[model samples]
Target: MEEGKPGAVAKVIRRNPKSGQREFGDLVWGLLPYKTERPTTAVRPIHARAETVQELPMFADAFRSRRAIVPATEYYVRTETDGRAQRYVVTRADGKPMAWAGLWESFVWPGDRVERSYCVITVEANATIAPYHDRMPLILKPEDWPVWLGEAPGDPAILLRMVDPDVIRCEPVAQRRGNR
Candidate 1:
């Protein structure tokens, strides 16, 4: 399975509302709200800010109900370094896969075809990533996965807390294959 990039599909885990069982599936990286007038990615967002995710019209509902987790081994980012562009790879220092917090939605196309899409959440960069970018993917710890996934009784306010910087590590890599 390939890691998700903007406009690409990625593996996801979401709690099934009816059965309360976790379901594993693939969802496109960009979110297309369920009742959008027409299908298009021009305005679809691949990332939602942690501060506004629950208040933003495009993502509020999904954040309240359709929470999901996108697992990945690495997160790549392109940023300027010494007046030149550089690629940085971010991963867990503990050697665990990242559980990225996200929201998923099902949009219906003209012919009534339903398409699933998701957007990763972002937060102010922690110490580990602050040098690379001002913002970074919101990674959830195992203990918080239940709340983020709506699988247990917990307040959504928990999301306001950012991931601990100690678990993350960043390395600048030569711009090469698989930059995305």
Candidate 2:
């Protein structure tokens, strides 16, 4: 994780579209060549703050090429309470599936082998999420999905404006206190 990345990790796993894998969704956690020395867990940074995307080498080229969409039922973020850290789950106020703007990369290691992985792109929080955390995932709206998913060449400025305060809803959860 970098200085601006958020908590929780995500990976774009491969799903065999023709068989049982298709029933489970198109993702299966896999190892990456970019692991930070420790090989115990593959839980790498899932959310990278959008503001810092330019600084992340993995995202620099990936963002322009293999940009992806993470369809999440709900995503978790963290905050602080009484000097203790807490987590928060951000779901659609309408209770619909929402997609997080993400970038996927292929990490190949030595030994004539290869490992691949993916990460979600986050952005500065809107009014709905700022109180809970300084940043939130760059969620694209239904109408914007085409542009976000590369159907259109998106304007960075316009895309940045998508994180407006009006479109989101936030709630505080009691279970969040246990995350720390």
Candidate 3:
């Protein structure tokens, strides 16, 4: 279990299914396994509401130590306006890829099988992404990558307050992003 928060189990691998000659059913959700105080089942909620990390214990620890940087060429977000959920692609105007703040952990099972999982951290959307949704992934500035993923532990409160707003630029995109 990463930082102690139960992770979402279904994970979408970065590989192209066609290249692997795999069926859609072959996909599996990645959930970080953890040892808890009781008989709690592992669950990968898949979608972590950026606003609720504090209430969820898993992120608390990772937010401090296991934090990571999730690199992305672009990211899809949904916005509801005029009664429809519109899809938006947020990218860098300069065309460079970016990374979102995240936390990761590795879990080993009974047969020496190891599972690595990650969760992107989020917070209230900045001015740029605010119009689209109330929450957005915490996009890390390149300069802060080392700090966010550094070996030293950080104070979650101080780190959470270090988001950069100007790095995100949102654009209207096709509704296909709304699909799972």
RMSD of 1: 2.8
- Order by TM-score, highest first: 1, 3, 2
lDDT agreement of model 1 with the native: 0.84
Order candidates by lDDT, high to low.
Answer: 1, 2, 3
RMSD of 3: 8.8
Report the number of the highest-TM-score candidate.
1
lDDT of 2 by residue, 1-180 (tens): 332233324433223223413112232233232534553454555656677665666456655655566677776677778998666777887778776776655554456454445566767778888787777778777777656555566754256443667556665556544443
True-vs-predicted CA distance for residue 135, candidate 3, Å: 0.6
Model 3 CA deviation exceeding 4 Å by range: 1-33, 36-41, 47-55, 83-85, 152-157, 162-164, 174-180
RMSD of every candidate to native, in Å, equals 2.8, 6.6, 8.8
2 against 3, candidate with superior lDDT: 2
Give the per-residue lDDT of model 1 (tens digit) for 63-127: 88999998889877778768988888888999899998889998878898878889888899998
Clashing pairs in 1: none
Best by lDDT: 1
lDDT of 3: 0.56
Estimate, for each residue in 1-180, the C-alpha lDDT of model 3 and write its tens digit. Answer: 442234424232222223532111211223353442231356654345456665577666555455555556777778677898778888876678766666655566668766656676767877888787777767666665545555334444455642456666787785435444
Runs of candidate 2 exceeding 4 Å displacement:
1-44, 83-87, 109-114, 175-180
